[model samples]
Target: MEIKAKQLDSVNASAHIKIPSQELKNEVQNLAKKASKTLKIDGFRPGHVPVAVILKRYEKQLQNDAEQNLLKNALNNALKELKKDSKELVGEPYFEKFDKKDEEIDIEFILSFKPDLKLDDYEKYIPQYSEPKATKKEMDEKRKELLKTHASLEPIKGKRALKEGDFAKFDFEGFIDGKSFEGGKANDYVLEIGSKQFIPGFEEGMIGLKIGEEKDLNLSFPKEYPAQHLAGKEVVFKVKLHEIEELKIPELNEELLKKILPNEKEPNAELLEEKIEEQIKNEKLLKLVDEELKAKFADALIENYNFDLPKGIVEQETDMQFRSAWQNFSEEEKKELSQNREKAKEKRDSFKEEAQKSVKLTFIIDGLAKLRKIDINDQELIQAIYFEAYRNGINPKEHFENYKRQGALPAVKMALIEQKLFNDIFFFSKTNKKGEK
Candidate 1:
């Protein structure tokens, strides 16, 4: 037997093992001797069968069993030589070579270990920003929006022009630099004035325009607009008003109050208002660190911390992401990629960067969770799964079994850890900043 092991990087190792043919034969004989004691061949008495006869009867099975034992022994020896515990290993160590040669069986295995993340002062990665707060005016607007949810749109009876808080349907075409742009035109688009869903100054620009009125409104997209081409660009929208309507909100009386708060103790208009305020405040708090903020925080953390990732783990993530994207690709795309190996590789490689980031964040989150002692116990995890299942009208036991079968429980746990870790960071960081308990 010969063994050689080397750490390739911080998180990966390589091992080469060799076993001579004579040694392999000796192992096979050992297994045969053990099996001979328990042999039950019709021609042989139990515990009295000859080793030669046993080998003859189960030559292939004995050899395979011996080979498996040898593989385990080889890995154990290699790990001992490397001064590493098998418990510290990441995913399975895969064989790069397991070929039988003239004199020996050669084996090469690549092992990946979890990286040691020194996450000192990691709280510096959290992005600093003011939390969103609900103003009285905004609260009133929320109350009105809630009212509109249960309201009906009624056409105006009189010849009234469009005004603030009025709903209008109109045709419009937008031009940029004297040329029309994509998504810059609409036909009979219904809009509520002061809703502020469109470009800034757009709804307000439509104010005072009457039915059958034709006008042109100049506007500019916000500087932080998602569309890069149209961001902060001046544009002209030629508009023609078609009709006007108003949201006929139901009266906030006893009947509507009961409908809004059926289970409340003595439901009333005051109770509804209080519920609306609470709902609006809760929404503002939940959305305080929105997607954009989370993304920016992730970016900052990735930039701040640098570490080497396990190559095998990254490859696994990249493969998974690529396969997920491939399933969503149109049939034509699949066919195109299938015919061109290079294009297929390029498409797969496109996910590598993102996979690397995802793996890094996973490690970072793990380290943070450890630092904060954040955890989701088995019972908590079970309760979460059950709650989610019930919310979605799924059988809790069935959902749990499905997750177990798909090997997704770890992913769920990790997500929960990440969520709790961030929540702790945000809450404590904000409270400390405010000098509050």
Candidate 2:
């Protein structure tokens, strides 16, 4: 087997592969011998047919199979040789032609390879981030929310009107145009007044209705309601209020504080303030770290390189992104997208350059991993797999093995590499926000 390559473009190259006649003959003879044992003929028993007749009968099919095998082998060998000479083959090589018209089979490949990149200087970085500081007001607010979460419900006093945050139980029946519709009646339904849980004006109409009070709820469904038949239709609900209750938040005493924060030496305002401030500080620190990392990573990428990206890779990425974006849209939104197809196309076309940059970044990162001997340990991989599976509600071990089996291991490898690279850059880079004191 021999391969000859010619430069077609910055991102694409054409290769002509040739398989020797001797190799083709050997493959045909081997396949014919294997078929002779099972092939049946009118005049001869199985395995007794002559090789020449077998060749004559199955020549076309055998030749096709042999040619496919030869092409695959030659492509693999050619790529391996190219990688040895130039280590920038970013993605898979695509085949353009494979022909076996005669003894010497001819094959052509349009390879999508990476180009050279020379990063510009990016040692100086100016970061931007918010510095959050918790005050006494913020702490008190959090404590108030905590008290509300642990609140107790109390029955309302006699002859009192309903109010917001008050729980009520009632029986009601709804009528539309003097006819009662299905799912229009309920008994002993529990509702929170002013929650707006029911249709527009339904909850507001329930407001001010006391125990054992009977009234009418006049409301109209929204125009864009889910039920097409009843949407925008006016309906009257005959209300009968049975019982009402009010919520009473508990006092923030030592006992309540102990229950919430166990093992605390002192459960008071000062202790609570310290805890809230610590939590806020940690949150701010994590957020700042993330923002800094992203800013630094993008700067590093912009500073380090420029290259002509593979058109096929960018097109593939754009299609993937379009599918993802389309899947997130509703049926009505899909129709809207159809109407504005040109606008959507414009957005995709704009993303092509960014996608190309991303592809080149991926290739460079992979190259860096090889150069620096960076790798993910088994424990780290197992933990990552566990986190992914737990988030998606799947069996961790099974998910990990499935990804490995499906040839998605490279994705995991790249993720690990990118994480490491980002961390390395963040630690080494001198970063400070513009307004930091």
Candidate 3:
């Protein structure tokens, strides 16, 4: 066996692997025997078939299968040999080119892998962040929100009039030019006044209506309404109030606090305030650190390296993004999208540079992860998967399989590792700025 590597570019390597004719013949013969057992032929009794007859019947196929297996096995061996005796091997191996012109047979492959980064000052580039402190005002606001969550609603006595936050039932019919329009009529529909749950001015028009009251609601639909014909059209609604009930908000006290904050026995407003402030400060810190780290990481990687990414990967990613966008659009929106395909294509092309950078960053990160021996534990992976599943309202087991089928397992694993790496890096860093004392 002979192997030689040629550099196509920074990210691509072409290798020529030569297998001896004698070796190829031996491999083919051995493979034929392994395949002959279950292979049926018209007068053959399983493994008892003669090799000459078998060769005569299946030599061509056997040789093809042997060649394929040889390519895979030989490629693996060549990569190992190159890594050990020559330069380092990069990403996954691909069979770029091949030839059988000579009886000796030479196979060529183009492998895509990450390039090396000169990061002598990786630690120095990360921005030093000041530790955040929760504020009293912020904590008070959070406490108020908690109090509102515990607030109870009670019906107001006496028939004054339906107002905002009041539940009301009514019979209404809307008409345009004296003819009833679509979606303009309902009988005994219960609604909350000033809820903005209905068309423009519809809820506001219902406000201040006494029991058994009758009133006419006049309004025009917005120009962007979903119903094209009804959009920007004026309609009159004849509203008849049937009954009204006032909303009673509950007070935040001992009983309310107990129910709302089960973790804190004897919880008070001050304790709730502290918890709220702490939550806000933690959220702000995490958000700021995550954004900064991503930007810094990308900048660091890009600063040290520059190369042309494979068009295949970029096209694949773009197509995936395009499908995602399309899936989010409605049927009419899809038609509009189709009509503006050139614009969409232009938008996609504009993202090519970023996509290239992303690919490079991914390759480098993956390489660094391997070099650092970074591995995600089963528990962490499962937790991340479960969190995502819960957010998407899907069963974890089903979602995991779906993610794998969509070829997103690598992405999920990479995301989990990247998050862990950043968290570990930030957890112990000291701050020299802000409220640190």
Question: In candidate 1, what are the lDDT values of residues 1-437, reduced to their tens digit?
Answer: 99999989988889999999898999999999999998788887899899999998899998899899998898889899889999988877767788998799999988889999888877666666655556889878887877877899999988877898899999999999999999989998999899889998888888888889999989998999988999999999999999999989987778777777879879977777787777776566457655554677678878888877887788788889999999899999999999999999999999999999999999988998898899999998999999999998899999999999999999999998888877677665553233212
Looking at model 2, how many pairs of residues clash? 3
Model 1 sits at a Cα RMSD from the real structure of 11.6
Question: How are the candidates ranked when ordered by TM-score, highest leading?
Answer: 1, 3, 2
TM agreement with the true structure for every prediction: 0.62, 0.61, 0.62
Query: Which candidate model has the greater lDDT, 1 or 2?
Result: 1
The candidate that wins on TM-score is 1
- Estimate the Cα RMSD of every predicted model relative to the unseen true structure: 11.6, 7.5, 7.6
Q: Which of candidates 1 and 2 reaches a greater TM-score?
A: 1
Ranking by lDDT: 1, 2, 3
Candidate 2 TM-score, C-alpha based: 0.61
Off by over 4 Å in 1: 39-64, 100-103, 137-279, 330-347, 431-437
lDDT of 3 by residue, 383-410 (tens): 8898889997789999888887988877
Question: What local lDDT score does residue 119 receive in model 1, on the 0 to 100 scale?
Answer: 85
In order, the Cα lDDT scores of the candidates are: 0.86, 0.75, 0.72
Which of 1 and 3 is the better model by lDDT? Answer: 1
